[model samples]
Target chain A: MRRMSWFNATSLTLGFVFLYLPMLILVIFSFNASKLVTIWAGFSTKWYGELMRNEAFLDAAWVTAKVAVASSTLATVLGTMAALVLVRAGRFPGRTLFSGMIYAPLVMPEVITGLSLLLLFIGIGLDRGVLTIVLAHTTFSMCYVSVVVSSRLVTFDDSLEEAALDLGCSRLEAFLLVTLPIIAPAVISGWLLAFTLSLDDLVIASFTAGPSATTLPIKVFSAVRLGVSPEINALSTIMITIVAVGVITASLVSKRAAVKRRNEEQAAGRA
Target chain B: MRKFALIALPYTWLVLLFFVPFLIVLKISLSDLALARPPYAPQLDLSAGWQGIKDFFGGLDFENFIWLTTDDLYWKAYLSSLKIAVISTLLTLMVGYPMAYGMAKAPEEWRPAMMMLVILPFSTSFLIRVYSWMGILSTEGYLNQFLLGLGLISEPLMILNTPVAVYIGIVYTYLPFMILPIYAALDKLDGSLLEAAEDLGCSRFTAFWLVTFPLSRSGMIAGCFLVFIPALGEFVIPSLLGGSETLMIGKVLYEEFFNNRDWPVASAVAVVLLLILIIPIVLFQRNQQKEREAGQ
Candidate 1:
């Protein structure tokens, strides 16, 4: 209702700059020919070439991709189930416990989660490996997906499912055909979110991963700990570009779908 | 039968993976450190039946918890972690509130893009985001270099590896968490209500203070908890950006577990950290439950 105040404008400008300037600096330095990150050197793709030649980093990236794919898929299925139970099941037994377990991971610190999960694996005699890492990721990322999907489920129109059931569809078919299609966007976004989270996670993975299975973040973290180098910068820049592109595309698709859905709804209203 | 399946599968998974782990951590915290394979004493062998159970119970003690209290470093780390978390949450709220307000007030068409800008950084790797700060906060980093270039300072300020850098890292990383929730609340606010306040002879600023601020209180609390809880146990920011003098519970727990190879102490630290976090977390859960009820 009100125009953008000068205060709000200044705040937004400053806030965005604070958020993006470090990333901008990191990207710019990734192209530097000099070994040092801060120094200005002639433009070069040497670091990117070097990253390509580094086997460990490549291996780490491969491991990360596998973990992301496997974990996110499992998280999505489990999370979708959790969201449905939370939204549609009403006050089932242990409802509070179910909700608590679902939401706890969202705010639980990585150190605690990592430590606790590691202990669980150790206690259960499960070997620390790629499988353990996937399990850990799935546990935490499932919570995130539940949060995303549950929000969508809350706003969802249940009448459509009711309508489907009234039209002689079975309960299962009503959900599969009507509810699932409508909430597919939220589910998809939830999967992508879990994928990114699993990919990006370093702490939990570090704790659970065996000696043979280092993820990319762990690799970069140890290398960066040795000090800033242009090669790591190059690797980081690549990772940033991939993630940024993925997020932007997902948002654009979702936004377009939302607009189209609204238009159809308006047309139906008129008819 | 189908409803039972839907609830049973995920519920069993969480109980096995999520809930069981915490129980294990608690059990481990009570165990004595040993030079054994699992690095703890009196292991619980369920296959051995009653004898193994008795051995496990016999070995359990409060020695690690006692040791935690005896160590000044552990207590100091916990205090400093809480201090940093509280201050950073406040800072994020201050920075995020105006930005969220702006986004909520912006043209409807631009809102999605604005929301995307906020979510993009979040979807990126957390470690890289912190790493980017290292390049900007180091003594020879970008910020100091820029200031030096502009003649604003005679020397490169030692911003990196300092507590201030940790603050910056926390605020930068958690700003989106603060903003998004607040924006959600503000966006849902009735424009007519603000107009009503103004029509009753209130200034626009007072209208916001009285009407908008109170309505957005839930979001602010939610945002603060979201930022504060994880930040308290944050390991990366403190380890990478903070100076040696900087102490946080997460770093200390890490050192105890890995460097010192002391699982019992680390578990004890974790238990304490969780105990401290319980209050805010329960409050957050209550708020979420209330919101869910309101929505339904």
Candidate 2:
């Protein structure tokens, strides 16, 4: 057991407080009856009720949800394929460049990605709307998904697929029956990550989204840019809650999967 | 055929969406802005065949690049962004390193949860996270209220819409980037190394400064790169948290495109930003390669 000194304890506590305090304040202030950040008015859920009544916020949210679902699904597919290419297709031609492209967007500025893609849409004469937004989201978020899935792929045993092949399983069949089942957790988590990215993205979505098709972040941005409002706080509180739950669930799912995989391996070895 | 299909699918997707778009940015950056619907000159009219390609190349110039250089705003924004990204990265390191060290020193069973605690912010909307601070940093915000209530200051300090707010936002948002890398390094350090140093007649602090810190250099470097590179071109944090004086290339590029509708100039700005980024990105890649080699 590593010793937790006074310094370490204080650092951890203070660090976490710094991290969580603002969000906690936002969430708590969301229920305030008055539209003040500091003043504690009586607790009421009126802001949330107002949020429900707001048609524009609701419509933007609906559009965001639709974009998230479509883009994340598409990203998962392309990302998994890219991961397979990076991991399994060893020493292929242009492998370095391929991997470079895969990783580049991870650190690329949101502005550059957004600007370039918008230019592409205009250059190719593609209309800026939900479809353009989906394409842009898929392009960037796929890099993230590939990173997640490829990390899992690295630790995966190559012999397991070989065992399936030795039993006369076709390559495709072996992949579907053996490889896919084991890596499903990573892929699922990848999808979740992509989904969250799509939902949270502001800059990329803003550039790609048409004036008529504003996403929640763009709407929230315009609203918050003026000043803090209880309605914006309520929206943020809800988003923070959703994302926290989603991230936790994804992490837990992956952990559980690892344990389950170990148990199945142990059982098979004993047999 | 199957192998070909697997490679081609994603390769084509990236080439089209990623690489091709980048080339278009490069091309447009050279061309002059036009009042046309698509808003750039010398787009190839293929019906004109060989003559069109010649015209396209002929119309391209270094003027946009020159314009960016001549404008004090563009270069100043670039420099200010560099200054901001560098300072914030250092701040994040100072704030993050201790937390990471604490996590590494924690009891084994508690480490995972602590790590998750660090990552939980990522799941939240970034705009919301930055916006959360506005309420706290504003004159009537909680921080000021608390300070005034405690009799720390008679007047509320103007923190919102200032460079200080932008710094706080960057450090808050990018803390995880710095922490995770440093934590990974610290976690992998063999406790025996510190003990060995201590047995050689060194204090715990000296032992850490000499042995553990040197060992964790790679992680520290990686963490810095991760923080600095993204922070350099960050749009959302600066735009939301920054005052008009908080000049960043990302926000400038954004305004150039959306507000001014100067697509050529916008593309030129992006091209330059990418050029500036190539240095750190290349170093990051080399660092990653070295780490991988060391692992092997």
Identify the leading candidate in terms of TM-score.
2
List residue ranges in candidate 1 displaced over 4 A.
A1-3, A155-159, A162-172, B45-51, B192-207, B289-296
Pairs of colliding residues, candidate 2? none
Q: Estimate each model's TM-score.
A: 0.94, 0.97
DockQ of 1: 0.71
Report the C-alpha lDDT of model 2 over B163-249, residue by residue, as the tens digit.
899899999998999999999999999999999999999999999999999998999999999999999999988888897878999
Judge the docking of candidate 2 as incorrect, acceptable, medium or high.
high
Off by over 4 Å in 2: A1-3, A91-93
Question: lDDT for every model?
Answer: 0.90, 0.92
Predictions: Cα RMSD each: 2.2, 1.4
* Native contacts conserved, per model: 0.79, 0.86
lDDT of 2 by residue, A24-91 (tens): 99999999988765688899999999999999999999999999999999999999999999988988
Least accurate 10 contiguous residues by lDDT in model 1 chain B: B287-296
How far out, in Å, is residue B83 in model 1? 0.7
